[model samples]
Target: MHPTIPGFTYRRVPVADDVTLNVAVGGSGSPVMLLHGFPQTHLMWRHVAVELAARHTVICPDLRGYGASDKPAEDAEADGLTYAKRTMAADAVALARALGHDRFALAGHDRGALVAIRAALDHPEVITHLASLDVLPTLDTWDVMHGTGAAVGFHLYLMAQPPGLPERMIGASADAFFGHFLDIWTRDPQAIPADIRAAYLAASRASVPSVVADYRASAGIDVVHDQADRDAGNRLRMPVTVLQQDWGTALGFDAAERWRAWAPDLRHTTVSCGHFMAEEAPEDVVKAVLDLLTR
Candidate 1:
């Protein structure tokens, strides 16, 4: 129920046996799927989707364990991991196919950006274009966060811990923990409306375990998947656009250079806004996605 994206309808799409994604779909044209990140749901795309809807069919979904989507508990015995980005990326591909979109432009922010990268790599034939906002590749990100840099991404370390403790600590005060990012990530607190912020907090609180599992997989199993891809020299062949803050300078790497390694056909630049770039600076996001489509 994103009031801003008028006429959009919500549906529960079954992407897997145990996973059903809550999706908001509208518009009618070349399709474009937008995915949200941590602490927020598909609602983050309200503004951008509305504008895109004028020329492209816009689909926004609460990625499996976020928003109003089904929250499946972690089953440790399911091989080494359950919430890997590969699993989440599968959901994105299935969701689009289920909606009759065999090929579409794809864009995502934060956690969703990671999923989009995985999707573009895994299902490039279906995802014609790719856009990632405010993130580095998961492998590069982990490399940067080791040692003293770990303090900057304390949440990454915390969630990477074995399931029980991180879940308990976060669940104890989910609102405070999730809300802390909402306050700090945005240069302007007014960028996200009060109601939207409340919705994000509520969703995070309700999906604590699923969300934590998502992070846990990133810390453990996700690295293995990324390494295998890098070792095999599997790079993203599709045209890609990445809009992000220049955190690389702080982390001692050329952000664009790192991205160029994976995205061979790439457009990488730093946007002026904060982590919630899509919402904090919707026009910039829309323009970037449009540029990706145009390319």
Candidate 2:
């Protein structure tokens, strides 16, 4: 068993479709759910979870295709299970309800952020506050990366390729594939310990198809949902905070300005840390969430 925080204990609970999720529970007041990003697990939030558990009921879970959860194969030809963010978002909502939190604060990183946004939009009654780290909504992300921005996000396009291709290519050198992001995305490499890095690579290697399917869903079905929301004039109604890298200069679009369109009560800022802000700059992330919740 992992060492428990002063107020939190680890728990494993089943969610939608008989999929059991490994979760860490801590703190007391209002419930707060944390969803981790790609190449990482709930363990990524060890530091932040404990800190938040001091004041709130912190609930951290390994997202659907990531650590310890079921990884159903994708049938990209049809709108398969992996193609829908709604399925993943439903898992989160069910997980929260299983934990007795009808409504709670929610935060997610990278791929997990996509799920968090869907949860807030589809089940606003269940998400009291929302925070997304290092990602824009699906359609806006695709819209911004037209020319040079697309080059920087080559994986986004590469992963969108036909099923067997991306899975085989990425699976061939999983360590290098996952490690490349870990090295380039983080301003501080030492934030993730060597053992943890190895574990991430191993888990990623074992789940190549699932990982590829996740990105593929972004390009296909997820974009459809995002566009539908745009056409419907939908926006997040709850308080929202977004922390991202300074992709403005690099990607040629102002991140804050773009997010303001979707979240009117948004507190968007670009941090100096790399994509793994929660692990690399835990204090800043914690402070940002606290400030947003209080606001």
Candidate 3:
């Protein structure tokens, strides 16, 4: 059927070379692109898109290898055209451009949040405003958490395993494997309905290898990009808003301060939700995005 959000139409649009993305577009006004995270689809923005669509054109897209998007086999040295953050960011940029938006406001959840950050850094001319949900920068995430705190992010390590292992293991019980994160990462289980959860599991299961490849690239090539940005002193010049759980207190960091190092005009807040803030707290997520756009 459809996602939890009511009265929205789904369409698949070709974005980059050899790739097309499943995107949900509705409402009418200034464009706002919403990118979903790991193990989820554009459906994650169901609630938030419905509300934002009332006043703005909401474009939600499933990133490559995640939902309905084309999942190319992993090629480690694909000449900068793999599922890494840079390529994924290009896909988003192409998607927006194909949708006739030279510039747009962008908000992303979890893994998508990392892509959004890279988009802002790499394609500053096209992204006007930026918002990240429930994730820190790649370098910050890897650097800040250690010991037991790092253990909580076991998926990162698990997905980083050599080819065929993670995919084969996760594929054995795909639903349970993907569902475990959905069940534990969110404070509100009711946020994602039964049918929607089933859809997520199905999509995630079919794309296990690609999913692992995406994460694997992050630990390797993605970090290279992040480090380059750090070395170049590149920072997000646009107005940036971040809504996340208070991982800083648990991991010994001042989250806002760390983000400020990357985003000079940043507004960071810790919400009362778990990792899936967009699905769990859609209204707040929408409000945060709209506020950033307005400011």
Candidate 4:
């Protein structure tokens, strides 16, 4: 029972033959896209999308393996190509163009943010502005994940292991695993309404293999992609704004510095919220997105 933004109509956008993204569209004006992260779908942007829709057209899509989108199984021979952010980002670009939006402002949360990062790097001409919530580039994410902060994201490492084992283990208690993050990553548990939590748990339970493969890809091929970007000196050239908690302070790294190296025109700030900033701090997130558009 994942309800979309009130005034939005949900549609299946064909991105590839085997891949069709579940997208919610509403309002009218310059387009703005919102992407959801792990264990959730386009519904994660419900609150933010509605508010933004008043002034700008809103497009919210469930990243490939999550929500109602097509979940292609793990492809060992494909070398994690199915769930790589590069491909996921391409899906977003194709979705935008399919809807007659050649360019738009974009913002994504958590895993969705990772996809947006890749999209901006690859399609800077299409992404006029970018905003990332509670995440770093894939490479820096692994780097800062070390030290005491590693405990906070143990699931990342767990899911990163060989696909089969992680899939079975997570599938065994999918609701518990999904609920665990919802409870811990918010300042106010009420931030995530009960129905929303239940929907996320249900969606995650149904796509265990794809979810695990998504993370597993991050550990393998995703790293290779990020490393390639670093070596080639490719950076996000669009105006970028990042809002995050002070994880670097607790995790023993400088969050802003890591982001600055990748986003040359970066506006990074520390916000007072937990990992789920879009849900826990919607006002802050909305303001940041609007600001990114202006910047």
- Highest-lDDT candidate: 4
Each model's Cα RMSD: 1.4, 1.9, 1.4, 1.1
- Tell me the spans in candidate 3 whose CA falls farther than 4 Å from its real position: 2-4, 79-81
lDDT (CA) for every model shown?
0.87, 0.84, 0.87, 0.88
Better of 2 and 3 by lDDT: 3
Q: Per-residue alpha-carbon lDDT of model 3 for 1-295, expressed as tens digits?
A: 6454576677788986689998878999999999989789888888899999999999988899988889988875673348789999999999989989999998988889889999999999899999999888998988886998788889899998878778888989888889999998888899988989988988898899888888887887788999999999999989999998866467777788889999999899888888888888888898899899997
Per-residue CA lDDT of model 1 for 1-295, tens digit only, reads 5343577988889999998999999999999999999889998998899989988999999988898889888888864356888999889989999999889888989899988998888887888999999888899998766666567788998998887999999999999999999998888788888899989998899999999889988877788889999999999988999998746456676778889999889998888878898888899888888888988
Question: What total of clashing residue pairs does each candidate reach?
Answer: 0, 1, 0, 0
lDDT at residue 4 of model 3 (Cα atoms):
44
Residues 1-295 of candidate 2 have per-residue lDDT tens digits of 3333345566778886646777778778898899989878887888898888778989888776777677777754568556377778888899888988889989999888998999888898888899999998888899898876588788999998877888888888888988998888888889988777877787788778878888888988898888888899889999999999766477778888888988989998778888898988899899999988897
C-alpha positional error of residue 163 in candidate 3 after TM-score superposition, expressed in Å? 0.9
lDDT of 4 by residue, 1-295 (tens): 4555798998999997789988899989999999998768888888899989989999998889888889987777999999999999999999999999999988998999999999998898999999999898999988778776689889999999985789888989899998888888878888889888888888899989999988988998999999999999999989999998866467888888999999889999889988888887888888888888888
Pairs with backbone N, CA or C atoms under 3 Å apart (clashes), candidate 1: none
Give candidate 4's whole-model lDDT: 0.88
Worst 10 residues of 2 by lDDT: 1-10
Which candidate would rank higher by lDDT, 2 or 4?
Answer: 4
Write down the TM-score of every candidate: 0.97, 0.94, 0.96, 0.97
lDDT of 3: 0.87
RMSD, candidate 3, Å: 1.4
How many steric clashes does model 4 contain?
A: 0
